[model samples]
Target: MYIGLGIVLIVLGAILAFALNIDIPGVGDDTLGYILMAAGVLAIILSFVATRRRPAGYTTTRESQVDPATGSRVDHTDIDPR
Candidate 1:
């Protein structure tokens, strides 16, 4: 999925950016290397944001909560939506 591709691109970019310090040809100079690294990092971050899941009817609470739509209570301690 997108997550996998993001991880791959990030890792590959890091490798390419550093070039293993082996001195490879056609890899460009330090400026281009840094740009590539920045672009890759940005891409990965965007991909993560794009692929994140947001559940519907979701509510944020640290304690017992009331379901907004159902008007029911969700007791965290009881594990029962009563």
Candidate 2:
């Protein structure tokens, strides 16, 4: 959803900069279009970064966790009952 919006903003900015040949009443040729385009691209990139993609260094290791009730090892394994 946000990615689509970013694409739209980026495309709109590009069009305004290169294709759109319309001049505002009190705005110069180089207005906020470039800023908008940059913002759009940044937003897209941020959305991608904000995804649920974990890095490579993430692991299920617990070598530094300390128990409060008792000084024991934390067993994270699963067991089955018959």
Candidate 3:
């Protein structure tokens, strides 16, 4: 979601900064557009960093098996270290 928002902001900023030409009393269109683009880039970087820091899902289980030669049952453990 955040990544998508970042992409949208970047596109809008580019359009505002480069494609359109307008004049405002106090605020400059190019300046605002650059700011938006910068903000979008920052959001994208933050999203990437946040996703990288997330912990992966994991599952663990135990299974029982019988040994043919010994005629004995053995238990085995399995773990996912994601």
* Winning model by TM-score: 3
Clashes of each: 0, 0, 0
- Cα lDDT tens digits, model 3, 34-80, are 98898899999999999898779977899999999999999999898
RMSD of 2: 9.1
Candidate 1 C-alpha lDDT tens digits along 37-57: 666677777776765653335
TM-score for predicted model 1 compared with the true structure: 0.37
Q: Which ten-residue region of model 2 has the weakest summed lDDT?
A: 54-63
Cα lDDT, all candidates: 0.62, 0.72, 0.89
Off by over 4 Å in 3: 59-82
**Any idea what lDDT model 1 has?**
0.62
TM-score of 3: 0.67
Output the better candidate (2/3) by TM-score: 3
Off by over 4 Å in 1: 1-28, 53-82
